[model samples]
Target: MKRLILHITVIAITFVSLGTYSQNNAFKGYTIEGDSVVFTFDVRDYSKFTQEYTGQVLDFTDFEIENVVVSGEFNLWSRDHWKMNRVNEHLYQLKKSLQDFDDEFSYEFKFVINNAYWAEPSKEDPNITKAAKNGRKIRDVYNLKMYTAFPKKDGNVHFKLKGYHDARKVVLAGSFNKWHESLFKMKKTKEGWELTLQMKPNIYQYRFIVDGHWMEDPHNTNKTPNEYGEYNSVVDIKEYTAFKLRGYTNAEKVILAGSFNNWNEHEFVMRKMDYGWKYVVPLSGGKHHYKFIVDGEWIVDPNNEVKEYDGNGHINSVCMVK
Candidate 1:
């Protein structure tokens, strides 16, 4: 009886361990980390395919991979633009920033082997999608699943509208989506409507469309006048941009000034770090020109490469916000 009880306890523990492993490692071919998206292609996840041009069946194993590249609409479907790094015998991976892609719900792409054959998902797979060109479907070409990633952490923005329970649809349209009327639909909640987006730091103007009627956000008082004799809601989604002046530890004071603040010399005092002086400030979209004032001596940013003339025959460092 003692031996039987010990055996039962071991089986229970084994099942629990297996269940936990299965839940955590359900491979999805991709992972999103904040602003970066990592695309992974595992040979074991796909099935055998026949090369249409060569009429040769390709069986992918750990030893069969020569090279792999990711082709998609973002790169005009080029066969060799974005190459993947081999992580192991069967895994090929590539990483890209969110800024590298245009604003879209999803994108279609496939992996290319040896820059010749396309690695496709099986028809039964949910990631499999038909490829099309010029509004016509292509034959014998299947793409992997639509892949996309959203920014997390500091990039998340939430918008809500209250007391529109009877409306059929509430859409959030703004400069982010080029003011498309139906692209971003809000979900109805117990309170009202809500939609969250991962957006870069910038100033944007938006309005809510409730059942085909457009109106500014009632709950938000910040607004700007539009040409149509109405007001549009405004939100400044900003990120902290850091400016540093290295090797200036002995300076009595350091100030940060730029085009964002009309070159005010008194604002944005820099703090001393271990290496040098630093200051972080929130900024909106577009280009800004700035310099560091160390001991009241004006100098351009030594670390930044991009610079431009300020029309007064003086050169200033430039920082672009996207």
Candidate 2:
């Protein structure tokens, strides 16, 4: 009788294990490189320590990728969707010529995916009248916030970003300052995480790493809208002006060069100005974004549009030279 009981217990345990495993989610990934986007399944953030995080590329060559959904964004919180592209078996290219934006303002890739009509992640929210209104369902680690005379300061570009393992101490890691935690160290508050990146003035691109999970901001302000459905945020940094722009840079041009930008050393180019070197490129003349590319360096402009993307695939910015 005891043997029979043991066998039943073992079978029950196995079934439970399998059930738990099946409940997990399978996510595919893609990268936002300049004006192009690439499909990949092997992007992993294996950060061993808090101060510094690590990343590795997983093997996705043999993986069966079907019914794939790929999207990109600039910011994570609000609804700012500057760069919106779909992923194909090979890769989906953004047809729009953002070289002007890249040349002047900066752009970054933000992403979110649906498990293909998968169930179980949904819950009941009485206040949420429309069930489909809930767009972002996944939770992540850290988020980004800007301070000072920058535009979009009115909850326009919110980023419910990924975390640093357990938030033991979360910092915004990026190439703007050697991907160091000290510079972009975020402040935690009851509302959420916050930080201020005093970039010089130039177009910049970056991503968020939470506890090794590579994800875009959940609360992205500039989330782009889509035809089929859903949205993606593309972060954009504007140009800098003396009164509006704070910080200092004494050089001809400041282009962006970092790990994300292949560290080309001469990637972005910042134009010069009278008081300081500025990326004085021609924008539409409305409220536009322009970053300084002084002496081969990239910095976020302290002043510009602070708009988020609508969930329908559009673009907007508020932190650049107008």
Candidate 3:
């Protein structure tokens, strides 16, 4: 059941032609510094008719644009099926007719401004706990990747993300070109804060707000993952190792007597295939993270491939483990 094309009058005519959105169409804009960028996005809420269908079809050519500086290839014309994604991260590829194909769905492209989030959902915490709720008045957490039209040459793509206790600065937005975030910040070395971005590969999702919370990329590579089970905010500048593989079912095989290798059938004895229990873990290719544990009592991961969040938080599932 995978066929849900998008086309709602090319997203209400580009929101009446980007009238009131800043940053060159900023619903949270981004365009990192030229060399290529003419992409557009809008999928007017999508549609569907009944009674033997009415009239509306979609197949937006082959939408593709990539991460890690310089990668873009575009083609979407079911009357311009609303476009974006034409990647080329320095020959890593995505433009050549959209690197063949491997399909997935849930494509909406109208942005009212949602830089998606997930900063510090617990990278183990240790002693660093951000996320608040006392009086509640803090927003702006968007750290995305794909920079380096020579951010310092040599395939650069580094970062630091120091720990802030009271904070005043720390911003990095996503989608490569929307939500530009002060032309790039995050440098404070001596082995604590570094910043680099020279990309052109593919795969990106981002988050990070610091003072007010919202974070990810404890390393990088944990692409989209959201729904009810959260964690879907990414960043993949490319070394690859972002784990986001989930699929479960009625899994419960325990015995718990004296504790065998079974350890009470932990992780449901590992499944991942028979069309249900599957969970892979590893993230660094570009970082973002979220999940759900169930029986043990950690929840989220309702199958959200990245709608965008960090504001209305909760409901996570995202990975980065090649």
The prediction achieving the highest TM-score against the true structure is: 1
Residue lDDT tens for model 1, 100-153: 875443566777778777675667654455665512222357665433212122
What lDDT is reached at residue 150 by model 3?
Answer: 22
Q: In model 1, which regions exceed 4 Å deviation? A: 1-31, 40-69, 84-92, 97-155, 178-183, 219-232
TM, every model: 0.62, 0.23, 0.18
lDDT of 3: 0.32
Expressed as tens digits, the lDDT of each residue in 253-302 for candidate 2 is 45533223343556445444455443323221123433334443444444
Q: Compared with the true structure, what per-residue lDDT tens digits does model 3 show for residues 128-229?
A: 222222122222211122222223322234444554534666655555534344444554444344454444433445555554455554544444664536
lDDT of candidate 2? 0.31
Ranking of predictions according to lDDT: 1, 3, 2
Candidate number with the higher TM-score (1 or 3): 1
Top-lDDT candidate index: 1
User: Once model 1 is optimally superposed onto the true structure by TM-score, how far is the C-alpha of residue 276 displaced, in angstroms?
Assistant: 3.4
Give all candidate RMSDs, comma-separated. 13.3, 22.6, 23.1
Instruction: Find the number of clashing residue pairs for candidate 1.
Output: 0
